[model samples]
Target: MHETLEIRLTVNERSEAVRIEPRETLADVLRERLSLTGTKVSCDAQVCGACTVLVDDLAMSGCTFLAADADGRSVRTVEGLARDGRLSPVQQAFIDHAAFQCGFCTPGMLMAATAILEEHPRPSRDQVVHGLEGNLCRCTGYEPIIEAVLAAADAGTVDEGVAGW
Candidate 1:
């Protein structure tokens, strides 16, 4: 016999009530249960930031973050970065700077950048580097990604059109 718990969470500005097992991770629940695949699961050990998502406005590793911990909180995934069919500033900057190659790490990078921008408003290059140090990306070599983040900060509206704050 297995035990399950029901949790209510707000994801991407949408409320979701789900029955989940005690051991289920937030990444699995979000990807499988809610069909939000943007929160990718790479190194489930939290070494890589591929599974990063904003939980209550703070960046968290979704793979290691238990679903139960997300109950009663607001979650913001890569899909929630935009507003009204428009891409968030960070997302647009990524595209403009060619920040991604394989694109697997784009979602996580974007999320991390968004979180940092929200917290610091205008982050320096070193601050951006320090903030995103946990995220690993082999495709774009991080130069473009860093530039994208800086450009996003320069846009001065990184947090304007986002959902879930």
Candidate 2:
């Protein structure tokens, strides 16, 4: 049996120390240890993007990341995006555009979209599509997701659109 490694992770906005086996995945740590189950684990191989989360502001697959690898890194899941019960712009855009259907893919989509907007605050349609290419939504057919990203970029606030709600 491999010895557990003491790892410290800044999750959401709280600091926590967890003992993780060297082989344990970040997704497991987040779900099983911290109880932040919003970060779903679908493709353990890291292709589906269903396990995506923000690591140091970059979108990364939790399933592919070792728990120890996240030591000293700030992790943000979908649960962290909002403040005081208010949804973030990206999240709000998703709601406004009706971007999700089953909602299983929304977390990954939001993570990817957040990363994309970090690069291009106001991305073009093509750029939006390109940025979100990594995330897959079997239900929405990609149209609503694209529109939601654009809408979030445009409205400048997920709750307040370009028209400033």
Top-scoring candidate (lDDT) = 1
Give lDDT tens digits, candidate 2, residues 1-165.
779889998998799999989998889999999999999988788788999998888889999999899999899888888867777788998998899999998999998888888788879999998877878889999998999988788666333433211
Give the local distance difference test score of model 1: 0.90
For each candidate in the order shown, give its overall lDDT on alpha carbons.
Answer: 0.90, 0.86
TM-score of 2: 0.92
Model 2, residue 6: displacement in angstroms?
Answer: 0.7
- lDDT (Cα, tens digit) per residue for candidate 1, span 1-165: 799999999998899999999999999999999999988999889988999999998999999999999999999999888877888788889999999999998899999999988888788899999999999998888999999999888775545544333
> Model 2 scores what on Cα lDDT?
0.86
Which 10 residues in a row give candidate 1 its minimum summed lDDT? 156-165
